[model samples]
Target chain A: MQSGEDLNQDFRPETEAGGLTIRLDVFQGPLDLLLHLIKREEVDIWNIPIARITEQYLEYLEIMKELNINVAAEWLVMASTLIFIKSRMLLPREPAPENAEETEDDPRTELVYQLLEHQKFKNAAEMLFTREEVENAVWNRPPDEVLEDGGDVIAVTLFDLLRAFQEVVRRFESQRVMEVAQEEVTIEQKIEDIRKCFLVHDQLQFSSFFTAASSKRYIIVTFLALLELVRLREIWLFQQQVFEEIQVSRIKESA
Target chain B: MQAVMEAIIYVAEEPVKAEQFQEVFPEESPEAIRRALAELLESFNARPGGMWIREVAGGYRMTTRPEHHEQIRAYLKTRPGAKLSMAALETLAVIAYKQPVTLAEILAIRGKKSSSSLQTLLERKLVCILGRKEVVGRPILYGTSREFLIHFGLNSLADLPTLEEFAQMAGDQL
Candidate 1:
């Protein structure tokens, strides 16, 4: 493979048979390259001149092969799609039967719309990246200092909360069978049980919430109930440190 | 109340939820506390400072605006060993690429124990547990966090360098 500098040096202004010399770097994927060609030729996206785009697309693929850049399967898939569209376009449009609708929907419309939408997102992403690069070139700040206020507490990330929930589920699952034989329980009942449990104990080790008597169903129901409490602004979950036990408590919503 | 919330954010090392704020203002109704939080959010939003208050993970915290990340990067570059360690990078890569993945899967790819490194990344607010995979073992699934994006100066996961590019770079370094 040629170095970037070597590739630039090898660049020639001489146009190919079709009068197009596409630089690979400007293209993000097969669709992007096709969109550029379509726009450059001023072809209607709804009525794309498939022959021209296909030629250019193939030429780009040839260039990629020449440069030994391994083409991913997605690119190949797009190639076939282009060929299919081109072939469909080549076939003469049969006149609709007298009673049929005046015009059939263009096959290219959906594909073209998708391509345009994708290009728009790609451009937006690129613009954002360029902006980030420029901003990153100038800014500096130290790691956030730990909160010093006596009441300020470190909050857990959603990931941590999810993980803690998962741990609760796992422990509950292991003891599920034994609980299943004991009795049936509903989520509402489980919530009441959990509320009662919390009422008795100031802080329950997250693990203790799921005991051998807890069925998988009961555990899941209980977990959902807890989440509902959190969402309803009735309860809060917290962890003191990494890998430490997560604690849940009734939110004293009212100060 | 505004001062109290700001003071709490300033002092708390971790993201502080509104509920935590309630603990500080125990006498205030949750509704009142929420109203104060809304006011605080508005005040921060109107500010011209580089830092902004953001609700992340389930809490409110102060972080630099995405526009100001380059400044943070430049500042951090001057400090040595502040860069993420290679192990952290690898672990993060696994999480970002194959998100909601389990520790077992991460270890399988890394061919080494990652529990400690994962814990470190979790502590640093880089990676997070998404949930447990509902498979035979129900292993905890991990993924990159929103802070992960903010720290890396990305708006989304798609902003991360492609897996192929990362692999090539890692190969060259190796």
Candidate 2:
């Protein structure tokens, strides 16, 4: 990738011919795309090289146009604005009035301010996205049912198992900087080990089963072994209430 | 009183404010009901339970504890909900931060048309019309809804961290 200063070196004809290969994801808007371009070039946002940025921006739009991407009217408007700004920057500066203390506003001032403001919310959106992801996992009680019948809970949600799995993984990851497990454990071996566990204890806390797992592979194999048992009807997973810890027990043959 | 408050919170589809309870028990003093609510909040929050009373969107409601989010998410995976698109979320963030703003202002900042994104936000009930700007064009003004705060698990608009705070956190993480 060319540095920001290198963008000044003209390659206009070649760029137009090749039409720069660029992947276009849906941008939130023109400012989003402009910020991305600015960051990619590692240019100072305050002192944007209008000509270079405008050329790259237009190239991206041209590629989008070729790919049959529906370039919104707003993008085209921004293209015009960039072109206008570039043209203004090329013109000679107007002489300041003798009595006027304030210097003439840089043509880039409004564009720069808009970019800064838009960038703030772009970051804000990312923050909201993270909050949404975290909050998505937290459940509230569902609206009440008209009638209720007491029954033993038999099905554990995958989330419960995953939470237990995550705890194990997080614990191991925090404890060791480098994981090098000398001994290898197979899924079948883990399954057999679990079966032996059930012989002594009728039920095991889902996470407790992984108390001895030392490596990522061991944890993954054990989790897979548990899933296999569940699929085979050899084991039953249960959660008594929403967000409760899971219990793993034998499926118990019906009389 | 706390028990009744707890039951109401459990059954409510939306967060129930203490003031709303006064309408239900007209004879009860507003302060008394508020005290009961505070007590309910304390007891529920103190318990080591999967769910607890949460104060969000200017009201009280039952929500699963953050610690149990993973387990709750596993159960919810079977029933997937639509997530906001980038444009919609960006629009929402803009509305949330500079609420009671007009479409023209939003467009000026985003440097793009966001009417479609605004439509999605309106349809989702995350944003609502605050009224017209009363300017030359009388453009419709938009603001974040109570549902927005509740959806984001915020107590109020004040609960939203400043953009600078978010920036600081991002900087620290890097």
Candidate 3:
């Protein structure tokens, strides 16, 4: 792994003599730059010439220093990983293991696979954005695109899923400690307790409902019961702001 | 009844919650609804499906299982004109990073007027008016919405990419 100062000193000639402006912002990180170089060179991932890749990788690092980019540790980590892999490839190889005959997989395959996978998702996300642009252009519809005749269908966005997951996690964390000592409570009894709580109150502070529970098992059961209620839409948890205490309101079937 | 719930989720393009079931069984109690939902959840978990129901945004919605995200991406690729434009992305990035910001501030950062782009973002529900900033003019403060979080697969505003990272990315332009 090359330090920023080391890479800068090495590449001083290129910046001082070459009369070319360098910018580190173009590359998000070393991995990003490496991926770009790999694509540009059209090199075989399985048979990557470590020497060539290392040269290009180091050159970029130097350019980053020339541009005065504050390179993070992630880039340095990748640089070390690359250097290690390169050295490993150059080392004298022992005789192939008995199982070596079974598979001829390259050691670099996993790295390439990870790079490819990351790029694939990144591209997919970009594509989704492009689609939104085209859709907006072609159709002059209402602000909300209401798909008619899907009565039971509810459009739950990604944010909604995250919010729900956060709520569940928060509930789990806050209630995990305080134990409500009493007789052993069954899941059925917990469900009954929750129903009774909802019946008396129009809404319960989500945290308050669990404060009475003492045992981990009871908490788990209560959590499961809460999930069941949520799944059934028997209760709706509403938080006006992020990280705020969520309020759970019983949903009337008629309403 | 559990089968019915599974069938409903399977055929529906979006998520379906247990309350949606109550429309079919109008007289059922909340307890009964809870039981039915428990059964449905158990049934779905037992069998394999590309999608599963989860409680989100105060309601139940079906989403593709995380394991199937790649397949979903492949299917999504088959559909045309779904990618976002660079300008839209930049605008989104601005809102995401400097959220609860006003249109004026966004324009200032962007170094140009962004009324049209702001309108587009608002229409898309990616950004929403958080409230009015108490300044001389009381301009509406804009922030990324929950839809924005979901689109980016972030749990909360805190999940947004670090300011340092953005600064590093911006350094390229320098």
Candidate 4:
């Protein structure tokens, strides 16, 4: 429960007794993970808070290491790149050229450009995902899908996948911040709150618990806690209609 | 002749080419069938209806009006066909606009390795190998499948909006 920087500092390098196990959740890869982190931080992608972002990035790596998640080389290289940029940023700026019009280039500029360029494609990806979601609802003929797989496959669009992934990432971010701040309300506390609500009502609206959030961090953590409960199969997310409010329902076994 | 052509187009599960209409009814000339198709399209446009015939992938098919999307969606819950992930979609988009492109071409645009995404798209039958790129590595060239046209509800590759159009749409949204 250390700060991101502290987590990196405290963790031993050789404690990787656990074998690498990365669940290939198709929606979340290296860039997607970085984008999620950047979005949760709510900073300009063009002007990243490199030092803090790098700390958080490495902290994620630390957790992944502990869990033995297979860290891709791209992620490691990006980490190195961030560190390289940080180092370059630390160095004193070079004096301007004789032309007097040119300015010394910031080391972060290249990475920032890459992120922005990546963002454009990501935006385009989102557009196509949305289009698929839209056009998918109406079909001239039924698509040739092997639907008899029996409840294993979730036909979630990238949009839903990304949204769900985003929520989890945001929740993870909040949880880290809470750990740093030493908050009174833990995810376990939120789980308890959810259980109490389920006792009172058959179903709970996701938004009803918080009409207006005083702290974005706590709300996100609560949502994350809710997801953890869902992961444990204690509850499930459902909606009566597309674009309707999501509701929480307790599993029959849990009752 | 127009009625016969409508019947033929209606019966087709996939898009029906004008040549297909001629081939099916060899007694009718391709020119006559083309005229019938034009007239049928004009009639559909003139009338207010849920269905409209549109050309896609070098063939014509009837599709529901976008305005009735919500109503149709309500009536047919869980019919929202197959989905492509953002990674796959981005890979597909790159291939879509810059078709007959190699895997490298797609990777260059997206700035990520698209091996898995491309495989997923191929499995979904949304994209297919057009041919070999004829370059040194000769990486397989990819293009949108006919199924992709049906899936995206596009009349043709030409139906895809230009990047500027997308920018304008984004501008409007903002």
For this target, which candidate reaches the highest lDDT against the unseen true structure?
2
Per-candidate interface DockQ score? 0.05, 0.24, 0.04, 0.16
Specify the highest-TM-score model's number: 2
lDDT (C-alpha) at residue A132 in model 4: 75
CA lDDT of A196 in candidate 4? Answer: 88
Given candidate 3, what's the lDDT at residue B10?
A: 57
lDDT of 4 by residue, A51-85 (tens): 98888788777776775766777678778988998
TM-score of each: 0.45, 0.63, 0.34, 0.59
Among all windows of 10 consecutive residues in model 2 chain B, the one with the lowest summed lDDT is B165-174
Top DockQ model: 2
> If you score just chain A, what TM-score does every candidate get?
0.44, 0.46, 0.45, 0.44
Candidate 3 at B118: error in angstroms?
Answer: 21
Give interface RMSD for all predictions.
12.8, 8.0, 12.7, 8.2
For A1-255, candidate 1 gives per-residue lDDT tens digits of 121333334333344576565434545356556666666676766567778888877877877777656576667878898888788877887876788754355557667655654443343334434433443443233234222322223456678778877887766565545332567777788778877876776556655666544566666777787777777766677766666777776665342
Off by over 4 Å in 3: A1-26, A98-106, A135-255, B1-174
DockQ agreement of candidate 1 with the native complex:
0.05
Clash tally for model 3: 18
Q: Candidate 3 on A55-118: residue-level lDDT in tens?
A: 8888777666656655666677777878887887788767787767522545566666556543
Ten consecutive residues with minimal summed lDDT in candidate 1 chain B? B165-174
Better of 1 and 4 by TM-score: 4
Regions of candidate 4 where Cα sits further than 4 Å from its true position: A1-27, A98-104, A141-255, B22-35, B45-50, B64-79, B108-111, B164-174
Q: Which pairs, if any, clash in model 2?
A: A159-B74
Q: Write model 3 residue lDDT over B6-91, tens digit each, in one string.
A: 66655543335567778766788767977988877777766786656654433444555666545554764533333444445556
Shares of reference contacts reproduced by the candidates, in order, are 0.01, 0.55, 0.02, 0.33
* Tens-digit lDDT track of model 1 for B1-174: 998898777655456777898888889999999999889989987999887776644667666676765566576554222455445565676677778899998765544466876988887777877889999988999988877765555556766567555444423322
